[model samples]
Target: MTQGVMSGAGCACQPVEAVTAETFARSWSGVSALAWRVPLLAWALLVVAWSGASFWGPPEMWFLYMTHWGLLFILLEMVFGVIVAAVKTPEKNPDEESGLPWYVRVYWLLYNITIPVAFLITIFYWCILKPASKNTHVNYAPNPVLDVMLHGVNSVAMLVELALSRHPSRLLDVVQPWVFASVYMFFTLIYFFAGGLDPWGNAFIYPVVDWSKPEQTAVVITLTGLFLTLMHLATIGLASLRDRLIRRCRRDSAGVYNEGFTA
Candidate 1:
């Protein structure tokens, strides 16, 4: 072959991989992923930045709290979600959703489960629950920003994310809420038994989990479990409804296209 022809052929033979437009763009794999993820992630990151900055006292105390746990979980899901959306390579199995890692998937379920649980904490602590028994829980100076983040924004963000994100929800997903609540319950018991102290140096993390009253603790947990179960069921119902509506719309569009073709 001529030298010029050989050089041209070699250049042409090298494979050039085409990068997708979304490769560098941050987006969600699911349809409404961006609508929900951006706000949820931004809110969680705000809280995380403040917490990491030592705004809420020692990291030791903040990390141990349930509020912080939920916050971190939100941030984790959002961060990992963006990563999976951008970096995941499509496989032969189109059935798979988001190609989320096992850890991220687990946390995703936990995040859905923890939504109501976090709100329960917020409603009780920030509402009249704290006032009814003021001496029991920690009495930190009020910061409206932190208060809103803890009690109000957390649940609101989750609900908003739910509205924007599309995912299949099944009855089996009920286990998620139980698993989350059980973990915190177990931790509370362990903390009680181990003599762990709260931010104010109290034995129990929440004033309600008194070591002296095991029966009361059991009752409280049982009630919480019931509430969580109800909430989980409601989530399933809504998800199922959404799926049906989407399918119906697609079917109708297909029918319209066929009619047009026939005409």
Candidate 2:
């Protein structure tokens, strides 16, 4: 009878109701729990095994490298998040007050933000930095399996959880990334002045941070900071987009039209 309605559609063509945020969240509550726990369990198993087999007797300071530190942060986040989710899921209420102190909350934020950072770091290193530095770098044979699991899968699982799970809100506290980046920036400065030697035998952990060329190092730092900021914003935007896209898709499949959405 109507352009949007099927010719054989009877009274079943009544207007469809819009799915609100709360409804969407409730629908995915069980999914969110499973999504986070699954990857977290995998991360714990892989890292623990990797540490035991490969890092049993390595230099203690080798743990200070950003890549290693990032892994630790990611692991901590997963473990703690799973434990807390067991106690009470975020789907319960994101704004709900936790009796925990401010420092603990800060820890949560860092790990949450670290997920995308970890992924972006690996992407930059493998896709661009590694290629450009090959001429000036020494070649070494390493296990590609663990490398992908660490660099690629670690980052991706976190994001997958985000896409599959529903957050209370799409607007994350945007300032959290700045704080996380600042703390690491402070660490880099400490390593620089303290004569910290990286596992690579260089004074700087990252090749880009090598101080021999002041001009290049400065450019690297500035560009890196900019990139981090941009990425943080991009991830936040993705959260919003993911929420809107999923909702719109569900509504369309159900023959529902959202007033806020346009074809």
Candidate 3:
């Protein structure tokens, strides 16, 4: 039931069936698997190093933040992606879409959740958090480098992966991200009640997320959930557009080859 099955018309909007092992192992560009694996490996290492350094520095409390959690997701996604491409075996019939391997499905699930959440973290920080911090004279970003890496590079990497990966986006995948967001909101409530503090020693994790102001916090959560839904929809649309463009290009190229051969 979870398998992506295309209709007779090859509708790009339908969830795609599990693809070939090679497709899972390589990029949409048809590049060598090493070409895909090496970059992911390097970035994974970088994420590990940065995370270690961040923890080692002052105010380790920042680890409690959602941006850092997003970083963790990025690292996990890359590591699992490398493993899948390296060790995943082909199905009995390469042409058939029985279903993805369990690990492959997990990796796809991470990709779906990670990408939009990364963007959400970035958007919320720069647009909402940073501006509010400015007026309050609070320093949300203690380190400029870490600031850009977490808020900027995370989303950029997700964008690059989106363009390169062969995996199809499922509209149903949005539920996974929504559930993840709900978990984090629940955590915030617990953290607040338990007397957790932001790095600056405030009672709330973020200035805008004041538990004492329940109405404001509720509005923030509701808006954030809506934005996440929109982001996932946008992700699906991008994948569909990429598929349509690739199919059109292949058809045109095949037509050109046939015309030349017959002439």
Candidate 4:
């Protein structure tokens, strides 16, 4: 009787092993098909488009122009390559869906590509454009649209990753607020001191401080710096609170899975 029970258990385990192996083989074969190839081709087209536009287009349209075009390209690639392809054949197992979503994969690819492009644009602006325009006395204002778009996307991405990843330790939760505050304070002091000296222009592109009088400029710079510092702190605090709430919601939903499985 003991030998018969052991044989029955062995038979049950063998089918599971066979099923897993078969599923893996099928998934691998599907992955080996056009999934990656289509994305690669689209990415190549994006590189060509961006390079051509930068090389041929006017200097004024360089940064934002290229960035916008690159984003559009990646968006299209995601829709066609990842979403369309994945939907054509859905995986039956929920465990397979636990991996990254199509949107996240596309976002990461775009982010990776954007980093190099941003570096190149910075080099071009500083090395070539700035020096050429320096003697011409052209006061170029920073593009507020580009700044907001880039930073906003980055912040959203960070929030998404934090939500999806497993729960953070208490240390990370505590350190996050302090790190943000300290960096904000450090930059606030630097901006205050630098603005007081030149008051007419900022360290980067535009000047917010009035430089007509030394005493007045110092006062304006100090006040502006304090305002910006407070703004940064508020932004950080709100974002941290929102993220914590989102994480708690995800944790609560995850708790249902185990109970349902047992029931």
Candidate 5:
């Protein structure tokens, strides 16, 4: 009778141990999968496609000039840094991996400052210099497909960064969307102003809208911008909320398991 009781207790413990090990393995596997699916690669591919298409496609000079080079620089900086880092120091712990390295952090700091500087430069070109040059041919209407691709890449990058980063506080999530919207709004204003001043200015640049009149253009641009801004805010808010809830549930489950084990 004593031997049988001991044997039953050992069997129960073995199953519990097996289950804990399985759970740990699955968690590790998930972390590994997330590391492999880096969002920067997707952004790089999109940049490459956009740049290649600009070279081969119709002569949308302004679109090609701004987007092709801008994206190239951004993508080159991001992708090169990540690839080199991966080759040199592949992350052993995927759960603790981060998208922003030291260099990337510095780069973003500079990028944030340079945005206002770039906007000032654009203002100088459009408001002061372009008025005298007599070249009233500003074409602000970019290809809708390309715009979609670019913004889509940006959205994916944001989400992936949110997922991979260790300290995903609510503050970061709340501020990011507003920052994005503000930058976009600034660019849109510049583009619209420049396009409006041009003699060949057309409202619809890429068949996405009929920007035939000033009022019509305003309505379209304002509505679209508002909608996208709201969407971005909602996406980040929901993702962060979901992450927090899931983490809390996992902690609760683990606590219960530990208590039960102690009992």
Candidate 6:
């Protein structure tokens, strides 16, 4: 059993024969419709409240930060999830796991983008930037509660969504976050040359992202790219573990049901 667990005997790391609308709509461990709806709605509300409270600075500047980018994507993802969960999915037999649809594929891609980017923003901020800010005596925390919500709670919400959702994590989808990051990097380059300022009125939007020092910034980007790769890999691992646990629970339940039937 231990070996089977370690080897991922029943994990859904890849797509099962075929993915369907239910793949994106249902919860892995839940039978009720409320499973997906309740959490998605809660996240949507929290995102709106936190974003509104912290959105006091120059309205335009909010789009310039990668933090806001993650928040915005998460909000959109949750709203999409809530809508999708409301729709009635077509029922099929256990053996009929075929006919994956285009929109379901798009929803899965959105999930791929949403989960990792949310974690990337949270880890990048708290692990790397927060300590550096302290050394420079830069108080990025104007509102401590808002800071935690943006950087800390963002990842927690994503983690919960990860465990609850039945979506499969394709390894190839790891490039999704990298593409998203590249777009923002390109924007920052244009913003730098155009002399865009951070909310603090500095010529560079982020101290760590100053293009004036191209070599240093390039190294930071390189390291960050590697970290992003690891983050996605870690997400895949966690998803596998969730699937493995679910498989075990289902197996045990089946065993008891069979024994009772025989009795």
How well is each residue in 158-240 modelled by candidate 4, as lDDT tens digits?
33322232211121122333333244335444555565222223332222222434575466446544543443343334434
For candidate 6, lDDT tens digit of each residue in 1-263?
11111122243232232344665676765454347546765766786566656775687777888888888778777766765666665554322323444445555666788788888888889888887677663556788888888888888888888887765575666789899899999999999999887776777766787899999899989998888888888788878677668767775321101000110
Model 3, 1-263: lDDT tens digits are 22343322233233344454556567655665556546865875786577557653355675667887788788888877877777856555332344556666667778889989988999999999999888664675767887888798888888877777766676666888998899888999999999987766778877788898999999999999999988888777777676667657665321000000110
Q: Report the CA-based lDDT of candidate 4 relative to the real structure.
A: 0.35
Error of 3 at 226 (Å): 0.3
Pairs clashing within candidate 5: 203-211
Cα miss at 150, model 3 (Å)?
Answer: 0.9
Rank ordering of all candidates by TM-score, starting from the highest: 3, 6, 1, 2, 5, 4
The residue-by-residue lDDT of candidate 2 on 1-263, one tens digit each, is: 22232112222233433322222222243444534565676776787468546642345754655566667777666665555444432333343354333333543475457765776677767875667657654321155676676667767866765565443221234356556666776787787788877656667656666766678878877777677666765665665577557656666444222221111
Candidate 4, residue 26: lDDT: 21
Ranking by lDDT: 3, 6, 1, 2, 5, 4
Which 10 successive residues of model 1 have the least lDDT summed?
254-263
lDDT of 4 at 181: 29
Candidate 5 segments exceeding 4 Å error: 1-34, 37-43, 54-165, 169-212, 252-263
Clashes of 1: 0
> What is the alpha-carbon lDDT of model 1 when measured against the actual structure?
0.57
The RMSD of every model to the true structure, in order and in angstroms, is 13.4, 9.3, 6.7, 15.7, 15.0, 7.5
Q: What is candidate 5's local distance difference test score?
A: 0.39
lDDT of each: 0.57, 0.55, 0.71, 0.35, 0.39, 0.69
* Per-model tally of clashing residue pairs: 0, 0, 2, 0, 1, 0
- List TM-scores for all candidates, in order: 0.71, 0.70, 0.82, 0.26, 0.41, 0.81
Off by over 4 Å in 3: 1-18, 32-34, 55-60, 90-98, 252-263
Error of 5 at 162 (Å): 4.1
Give the number of colliding residue pairs in candidate 2: 0
Tell me, by lDDT, which candidate is best.
3
The best candidate by TM-score is 3
- Mark the 10 consecutive residues where model 6 has the least summed lDDT: 254-263
